[model samples]
Target: MTSKDPASPGHRPGADHSKHNHAGHDHSRGDHAGHNHGPSGEKHGPGDGHDHSHANFLGPNTEMIFALASGAALIIGVLIDNFVGAAPGWLPTALFLLAYFFGGFFTLREAIDNLRQKKFEIDTLMLVAAAGAAALGAFAEGALLLFLFSLGHALEHYAMGRAKKAIEALAELAPPTARVRRDGVTSEIPVEELEIGDTVIVRPNERLSADGFVILGNSAINQAPVTGESIPVDKAPVADPALARARPNSVLAESRVFAGTINGSGAIEIEVTRRSTESALAKVVKMVSEAETQKSPTQRFTEKFERIFVPAVLILAFVLLFAFVVIDEPFRDSFYRSMAVLVAASPCALAIATPSAVLSGVARAARGGVLVKGGAPLENLGSLTAIAFDKTGTLTEGKPRITDVVTASGVSEDELLRVTVAVEALSDHPLAQAIVTDGTARLNGAGIPAAGDLKSLTGRGVYATIGGETVWIGKAEMFGTDGIPALGQEMTTAVAQLREAGRTTMVVRQGGRDMGVIGLMDTPREAAKQALLKLKDIGITRMIMISGDNQKVADAIAKDVGLTEAWGDLMPEDKVEAIKKLRANEKVAMVGDGVNDAPAMASATVGIAMGAAGSDVALETADVALMADNLAHLPFAVDLSRKTRSIILQNTILSLGIVAVLVPATIMGMSIGAAVAVHEGSTLIVVFNALRLLALRNRYAESPVAAQA
Candidate 1:
């Protein structure tokens, strides 16, 4: 059972995953570096100077600054005409030109590209109308409108692009080179060169360079990058049966391995089992790419609408032109007015409203270590009704450890521990590691011999000779109930409690006598509860946990995590059934960390997979993959989406609402320039509001009031 501790503090600053400590050995000067020519590509430069390649026209606030400058110039020009006498045409012309080229050049280029593609893009229309207005001597109006709109577009693009880069860059955690072992020799080679069945030695604390299986040694591995779980997994040799029985994708508990995960403490030698591109990181990239293909009803409708929107705008423009001509307005004035109407109705702001918001949201999510694969899943996340999680590896640590031990009359605690740890030392089970670790510490320090004979009994126990006495370490049931009283009620009650707490309790019997009971549980993360409370307070309801463990174990964890429902002993199909049941009425999100969770993840309204701990199948099936293993990320994602949706609505309403009030007034000739100015300025305001999601919150501080809404 995973026990969560919500109050844990942040990690050590500057503690990147790339930094590895090799247990008093500096592999940096080892033979591997001499063979690789790794430094051949290096070109050291002064760190003080800027890297020109990283710099582009895309400067922060450039768009907003251009918009403000152009808008102010237009308002100044109009004010000169309205209040002071008319300024010289050259003066206004010069100001307008400054704004036009600075603001319009980039936009015009994009507009031209769209036109070349035979697309009646809003940018093209806006450019044409703004230029036409300047030609008609409404220089100030044209320049201001052009600048503000262009700024919004640029800012939106930058924010969205940043998010895409973050997702694509996540796989960089895996080192490019791996140490391959062949014929008892070690050589460093690019990770991509690795193939199945090759033996690779991953030294202590180094990230696994590729996916493989443990061939020798043992260690604790922290796989938070793929599974998004922060806990480290203890690994042993494949000889341990309990670990052997673990699901194949669970990194083989002892033998199997993954790419891009770090060795927490010890070391392991693994045989390559998967190709580089088939690794967990690659699968997440593939899944995120595929999620873009899934569309929401709103998205589909909008795309279809955009297809016809341009032609419809043309018809409206023509109608306006004819009406003005029939009303006997001056030909030039009527023509420019008609163009303005088309520009105003081009849906430029509306076109950007949803995607810009979604993109910003996705990018913001990435900054906070959440990956929202597409607009559809992002939209679903905003309204999630129920979230179901697999108990092990999803809600809990998945690495079960020995928390308690009890012994019978003749066996002292130390003797029992020593015998148990000795037999377990011969195996690779997580429980075995716990016993071996705890027992080794006590034995070596106190000079007790680690046991031997160490023959494991299939599905039962280990047979070994300890201190000249034949010992059998396993369950009471492993030895048939001859005449011994069934475990006492208290023992049974204790076992029940352990199971309820999501523990896998194992009984250790030595030579037909009950030696002791060892309880193994996967404790929950420290941040789970606080994050859950934050989520609930923010409007989430009906949390659930689904697991392959027994009902007693599942129930215990559910109670602790504050889940509203718990289902245990579920197969993949069982999980899907649970999702189906939940989805019968409301949106459901399934969070999981194994291959078994794949189908159910796909079936849910929104599927979240732990990037650090999950297998390729599970990652591929999920709509959103959390780069960090903290479940708190789910609620953080939800918070971001909801906030983004709110921003979109605000921008949509603000833009359309201003147009509703100003468009009619402009048509009525009541200071149309000022009305247009307000409309344009408001559009810029709303666009900036949407971009604010880029600032990710690092702490669970009381959210600001603006975010609360």
Candidate 2:
């Protein structure tokens, strides 16, 4: 039951196959940012001078320490040169050399590695610029450049490390062992040793071992850790097959449980259906782990930008270095100006701008229970122009519910509900149960007179003795044919109207007269309307519903939920076609149940799966999985991604603007020291700007665990 590799198993085909290289990272924290990829997708050979910035050559613990050491040495050298006139000139030179030694240690290692790999990176650019400064007798400027570059690099890593901590926490949710009950004996064992059909006992407050059916006992399960569902759901055994088959499209009682969900006070036993490592939690961890590898659109553009920008900057620096020779200017001045320009236009900030934002966005989304597959989907969700939703289990509650209560002229609404609840409370039919459930909820725990001697009229409805009176509740034809008087015109018209509106109608008769009509259907979720309104407010104007049900039912649900359009009688392939057509004109997102509508979802700009908590298929196939199955979270995801995109744009503007300003300033007498200070500041600024997404508040209410993130 090992988790699948995101890159190998679940990847959508035709994705990028670029040769992505990291600008620099501390591998212990697992950074795989996009940088240094060639447009031609060619592999590097030896001596290519490719930059692989290993900023922490000593170790993660000493990265900042080394930066401080470099600053200390440079400060001491400056003091000797300016304040101590009696100090030997060789003494300041020695101190500056020490500063270079401390700061250039990791840079030197990376430059050598890139030389061996035959590729160039930002590290090579920094080293070359520093050397040019030193060759022009600007030892102080070169030392300061090295010191600031190393220090800024260290600070950037420390800040991004804060965001990665949340991602690492998600991987730790599932336990490594399980208590197995076998041959009437219970024993603790490694989860890997448990096979399908094996019985696992879960005590109160214990996380599940694997995805499985609860075969015995019942308990409320807290699924917020894996599913993002704030409320705990009661788990029970599967219903009897015979009883479940009594009604068509009746909602089956939920019995399937997922790994990593905590059991409540009652101990339960589950039959393992999946290997522990292959559970949905494992796949979520895998997806988040490989997220950086799936480069965002901005990352791809950065890669291409660097492929040309690096070589061009190097050529420009060389031309500047020798340009003064042709005009008989001082060689030292020409060299110093050239070095400053090289430092100014290093593009170091550009290299880190997108990846930093993308990484933080991915971690933030996961913390909120939205599993964004990669940076590509995260950006795509923000850019989506339209969204199409699946109906069953998506827009609607996917089960029957009492929708309306129409009363006679003299009868009050409570009276109709009270009489209906009393009669249906004694019945076992699915429709009857729905009436009882909704009626009880409406009654707000009020006492109701009981019914007795309930009689079932096959193919019609039921009759029960209640409060010393007989009541008949059934279909429209059941009354007139069975010694029962037909309903008056108003009640009759009300029944017909409810039917036309795609609701299941139940006619209530008492005292030989029509009392009222109770209408039932798989009603829309309470949040569906508000969720759609939020989507519209967020600029998604073209909202649509696609369903396999009849046109009337689909349209009815769509109107109830505020969708802009509805399409019914759609097969799986029909849904795909609809998505492709919508995608042809605009960027579209297909939101569905995750498994059944995969093709359609894949056809759109981004595929969002609802309630993906326990389903591996949902996590693997869709671009984003809303683990809670709540439509309310959909808007949260979109809003977060939009915020992420804006932050990335801010970073790009600031990073590139610094370079733009510094280049001209350098050629007009900006010192190499000043250029390096501003260059390093821009790089750190880009990183901190991206980190702002980590704190972006989503629209949904956060649970205690999510609030901690």
Q: Against the unseen true structure, what C-alpha lDDT does each candidate score?
A: 0.61, 0.76
Q: Per-residue alpha-carbon lDDT of model 1 for 301-373, expressed as tens digits? A: 4456655655665776677666654786776666666666655554444444555466556655654556677
- Model 2, span 233-343: residue lDDT tens: 888876653332233123232677777778999999887766655666666766775775577898788778877776787788889889786877888888888778878
Candidate 1 lDDT score relative to the true structure: 0.61
Tell me how many residue pairs clash in candidate 2: 9
Q: Once superposed on the true structure, which residue ranges of model 1 sit more than 4 Å away at CA?
A: 1-111, 127-301, 304-312, 324-334, 439-457, 467-470, 481-503, 613-619, 670-680, 701-709
Mark the 10 consecutive residues where model 2 has the least summed lDDT: 12-21
Give the winner by TM-score: 2
TM-score of each: 0.68, 0.78
For model 2, the superposed segments whose C-alpha errors exceed 4 Å read 1-59, 85-89, 201-209, 215-219, 237-255, 262-269, 402-495, 504-520, 702-709
Count clashes in each candidate, considering only residues at least 3 apart in sequence or on different chains.
Answer: 26, 9
